[model samples]
Target: MKKVIISLFALVAGTGFAVAEDAGCEAFKWPVTREQALFAAAPATPSGGTLAVGAAADLALVPVDKAAFAVPPEHAPGEGTFGAVASVAVPPEGAIQISLSGEAWIDVIQDGKAVKSAGYSGVKTCPGIRKSVRFKLAAGPATIQFSGAKKAELKVAVLTPE
Candidate 1:
């Protein structure tokens, strides 16, 4: 009985590990096209918390805790840029408004290509002025890449029309 129990435990644990491995960030391919990123229809709204990319709502607020993740390659404030990835599911039609509350630039990537980009302009602040970029989005899985001046925290909001 003791041996049988141990074997069962190992099987369960191994299965859990496999599931986790498959869910890792590597599973997502970057720079997908706008069309490729669309969902068949609008998905349900997401609740407040750490922004869940593929499960985010029409309005997703993402917090950039600099201490939480490593900074990506640098770029001029409004020029080229790099940062972390947030998965988002856009509607079949309409536009997504990407806004930043600090010194940061955002790139919307579908199928590993940047479809749209919003850069920062004006004076930088702790909770900086709201800079935004709006573009048409198709329903699907899209990646939002954020890069900006080194700061303790930043807020990013993705808003879609009602």
Candidate 2:
């Protein structure tokens, strides 16, 4: 019985002897199933884009030089990187979530100042999205800036928390 239980744990743990972790979308620390679903149905948005609540956007980013940010990014991208500046409507609850499909620097700016992140979770092994950051916003318009992305294209989802 002891050996059987140990074998079961190893299999579930993906110890490499029998199974391995695929590290799928379900692996994030917090559930991002909705964001994952949004990515599939999202449409591309240009640099001066507006992402509605509960929707995703395949952000059509540009070279760092042309991102035209309202306030400069905290982490400026070196040559050959990509970025985008977009807006999202914050709900009255003042809590919002932003999810990304790849690695990049995220800045949420409101009222001409950068908004600090309240919570963040990321999973490198997940394929479609890399991180999700939450913020307590002012329940109005907010600017989201992305910089230092390896590619000129990154998928993003902006939504109110569930």
Candidate 3:
């Protein structure tokens, strides 16, 4: 009985010491200087739309008829799904940024399949600033889409590997 108890104690102690640990990744070192830090910041990509010169135009102009604007009844509000468009191409190493005028649920699709999805609730008034999401795509091109009941306008931008 004494030997069995001692063996159990030793096994428990050994198992505790073998737990997983988080190692600081040296490859992801922080910025050394303020200038370098600023440079290291992620760069924003241009929207795939026309450039505006003055105060921004109203975003909610009906691009299509009301029936056309209606989302498919089956599509739920959440991440990883879009009511319009089929696929998005994401670079293998960078991320994608989307600008919206209202709240939305965004979905990410890759290689003709749904990879993941996320919901982004409203922050402020309509035509809010852009929200960026980073996704590592060692696999291939990715497609992202946004769908929600809110009448938000949206534009998409893609960032590629340097």
Candidate 4:
């Protein structure tokens, strides 16, 4: 009986530790500088639309439509699974800055391939916080996709290093 009790306690402790560690934001590397440019503020309509952006137009404001994506039961208010695509043109190889209205999982796709992504266990309880990710991107066309935001409508912005 003593051995069984000890083993059970150890298993439970280990599980708790694992969950804690997995809850962190490890998939996306946060940007060093919070610099970004504000572009357009629009709604991420049901039939998603693509916006043409240049290095000059780094930041964009688009409200997320919660009804567009699947929301899990445990999802917090202002949090839902949503996706928006943006077409960007980079003059030269440089860094891309992406900021979302709330906690979000981001994916950067270029040439039909995913170049970057972010993963988190649960919704980030950031009501007005703008979570951002910066990545090195090649010069050309790239698509930025955002999902798992903590709000029904979110502001999506993009920036390229000057």
Candidate 5:
């Protein structure tokens, strides 16, 4: 009984598994404390097939086939991987950051073209996030796509940096 309990404790503490909340975010090139906190919180489930999300809305996600993309993803998913896309309204701030709970390809498509990333950072040791991508966006709507995900369902967050 003690051995079993110790094993469980070891897994919870750290192992060759996913990260724990507040673990490795500070290592990121830019500060990701806000994103880390939101990711630690229970994610909001999207209603319908559409994805109109706001700050701290760490989403459970919507999986879709590659054929659904009006514009192809910048990086394609490897064999056996999955993908997800969300139409997000970029706030007037003109720049926003999208945080991911898993490793995947991220693309922000607006007006049928990909918006270039303004900043990029991620750490494998971060418990709830695998990476975060920032884009310089116009104040309006954009399509955020995630490809090459090993899992069909993933958690995501889109936030306007302060």
Candidate 6:
């Protein structure tokens, strides 16, 4: 009994796996705040499918917290940008594809810098509605950073070679 109790305690403490504390739309029983709404917009992976983000409404230059949208920085030199850190182990020559959505702009970043940026303007079923980009991985794992969106929601996915 003592050993079992200690093992259970150790398991929870050792690994950082905890129940999904962030209540999804339930916590805010009544009036919902912008922050709450924004977080809720995050996309969830289905049973079997590629991962990506989604937006609920048309996002403008300024994003209302809790609103489902992608983050797009402005056109300024150091303006529109998003931050993401990735270091995946690659065997040899490999490539990956990144998909994004929302009313904001997004840039594909690697190694703490922006490699490619795509401007996303919303039109009815037109090109800017939702966008995607692809990048060929280098020899090893690489870090990526994205930025430059005025007020848009964004999502990213990494597709490895099969």
Judged by TM-score, which candidate is best? 2
Kindly list the per-residue Cα lDDT of model 3 for residues 65-161, writing each as its tens digit: 2313223323465433223332344444434433333344455555545544232222232123333334444444544444552553443333331
Cα misplacement distance, residue 70 of candidate 3 (Å): 17
Model 4: residues with Cα > 4 Å off, grouped in runs:
1-47, 51-80, 117-127
Clashing pairs in 2: none
Give the runs in model 2 whose Cα sits over 4 Å from its true position.
Answer: 1-23
TM-score list, all predictions: 0.45, 0.84, 0.38, 0.48, 0.74, 0.36
On the 0 to 100 scale, the lDDT of residue 99 in model 4 is 60
Off by over 4 Å in 3: 1-75, 78-82, 117-122, 125-127, 160-162
Better of 1 and 6 by TM-score: 1
Cα misplacement distance, residue 140 of candidate 6 (Å): 1.8
- Residue 83's lDDT in candidate 2: 91
Candidate with top lDDT is 2
Backbone clashes, each candidate? 17, 0, 10, 8, 1, 24
**What is the C-alpha local distance difference test score of each model?**
0.46, 0.87, 0.36, 0.50, 0.71, 0.36
Query: Model 5 over residues 43-143: C-alpha lDDT tens digits?
Result: 46542234444555544434446436657888766777777667888778778888878888888898889988998887887777788888998888788
The full ranking of all candidates by TM-score, starting with the best, is 2, 5, 4, 1, 3, 6
Give the backbone clash total of model 3: 10
- Which regions of candidate 1 deviate over 4 angstroms? 1-82, 117-128
